[model samples]
Target: MTPARFAGVLSAAVTLGVAAACSDGGSPVDPGGCAADLTTGIAAYDLDGLDVHAVLPTSTSSCIVANADSHFVAVDPSAQPSGRLFVFLPGSAARARNYRKIAFAAARAGYPAIVLTYVNDLPVGVRCAFGTGDCYEEVRREIITGVDASSRLTVGPDDAIEGRLVHLLTAMESLDPGSGWSTFHDGASPRWDRISVAGHSQGGGHSLFLSRETTVFRATAYSSAGDLEPLSATPVPWLDGSWATPAERIGGFISEDDEVVSPSGAIAAWTRIGLDDFGGPVSVDDTAAPWAGARMLTTRAPPRNAGAVFTPHHGVTVVDGLTPLELDGAPTFGPVWAALSFPGS
Candidate 1:
């Protein structure tokens, strides 16, 4: 169920309820249903007073955080928060800073957002040289062993990623008590029930995994990668004839021209999860068009730095110049911001 389809279904449900009420001779139902308008322009939320902070992890137990190799970018609202927390994870070899645009958009909408960078055990040069298959396995092993051996927290035996994430969330909760971290962590009578998580490439895969691992996150948006093995292994239903997450809670974006992660794989994953076809790909030249209603925005390779080895298509989701319609032409947010901000609206 794509977000568009989910919206349609929700609208239908509301209509049916209204009809039932009318038939019962009750008061007329209010015409206004859900507050979100999928086709409407992105909201022009104010970003003034939003503070951006860089935090270096001091916990030696978290190998990914305390190793001096990993850090995070946090965007917090100046006033009391709305209790909405958005977590962004970067792709392999990419740092948190790359996704600052998305975080800035989330902050503008009154949600405190964090862009988290994991240990880049495999640098870009090494990854490009060895290829994704070998480097992926090596990075996976490093995360597993690193967290199991060094982490003080324990989500589960096979949940090293979740464990490290827990540590980070704990640290962030302490950093800003008013930022709603306590609501996320307090098991008993937690002030908040769930959060929003988004990522790109490898980070996207991690976001998907976290969705299944914890019910703490109410929504997830991811791009560039759709390795469904982890989701399949978990009890969460996705394309395997089991119940799946509500479409409104799961948002995805992928470039048809992406050379790194196959667009077909992403489509297959989306199909299995039951998303309606939003539309054909947006041309690279159509970067200025509004992307509020687009589920998949086809784009050409983004311009790369001189002598850069990797292709630009792979980095489309994190490009700094892109913006969602909600930002009203603010070029600071990427296309993925639509999905990240969708559930909040």
Candidate 2:
């Protein structure tokens, strides 16, 4: 979905920060039952996922302290009557905004997406001067710190943090019209038959860890690099310390030329993603030289008439910038959407 198309639906009062699917030639499936004005141009209700909610971590640990303002947004957007869940943990505030486009686009396509807005809750004076290269390191440190209790930075993990992350998908399964108004829902009750977690930059690292650590998540989609040399100080393994099984459902989107996450680590990870039947090679390789030993899902440049589609731009703009509508036609989501369309891939 493009931003313009998304803005068109602003007539309805769905909540912010988090935001899919359907068959052909049918009336759009909006759980909210929006007015015709709001649903117009929706183009067959290609999507229908919920905004769910957000979570704020309260830990005082160095990682959490450095990232006290960060939050997580959880979503569920599988094809079943009872859908699957996906969590988006963007490393930066800008990255979070970028996912909003993806979330809305997915929602338009009928998949529920959650755009985490934890940055909005950050302390006013906080600032990181590092460029993209160091940014990843800084973000990684913060994430590790956030999860580690022994770190010098110390704070309490708000009890709600875990629940909020889990509830987005849980709520999707037991969705009732009245549920939308509730601020609290018990995620533990939901049957998470299939869960895929994804993120960008630092978020991607977290997604990798979450997918590996959580038995409930069936697959994961991480963007950028192969893998970082394991953190020097931390005992927690990168990806999952316990050596979680190769993700039966692991895939990532790598820009042939992404500077933020060097394609190398991402390619290396594909070696693992390919071990299982559905695990291998769902990667959308943008470079001419595909990752060795990995199946590549290559994309041709957008048709001349269609203007340029798909570029190195980060987040949802990777999709939204291509379309005519403010949000209806984002192409950034094409790859992720395509992956989701396939079952057990």
The Cα local distance difference test for each model comes to: 0.47, 0.37
Candidate 2 error regions (>4 Å): 1-80, 108-110, 119-147, 150-155, 159-194, 230-246, 273-328, 332-335, 340-345
Model 1 lDDT-worst window of ten: 20-29
| Predicted candidate 2 versus true structure: per-residue lDDT over 1-345, tens digit per residue | 346534533433133212222111122222222111212111212224443333333211111222334333323334332244444555444334445555554444433455443332321112222222343333444332233322323222222223333323332222223223122223232222344445555455545554554454433444434244443212122432343535445556545444444455555654544523443344443433223323323232332223242333333213334322325544634544435322333
> Candidate 2 at residue 164, lDDT?
31
Model 1 vs. true fold: TM? 0.61
lDDT of 1 at 7: 59
**Which residue pairs of candidate 1 clash?**
1-274, 2-275, 42-325, 42-326, 282-298
Highest TM-score, which number? Answer: 1
**Residue 37 deviation, candidate 2, in Å?**
31
Query: How many angstroms is residue 31 displaced in model 1 relative to the true structure, after the best TM-score fit?
Result: 47
Error of 1 at 60 (Å): 7.5
Q: Tens digits of per-residue lDDT for model 1 on 43-153?
A: 112235555545443231222223333444355555345567777767767777677777776776667776765554443223334243333333443343233322222
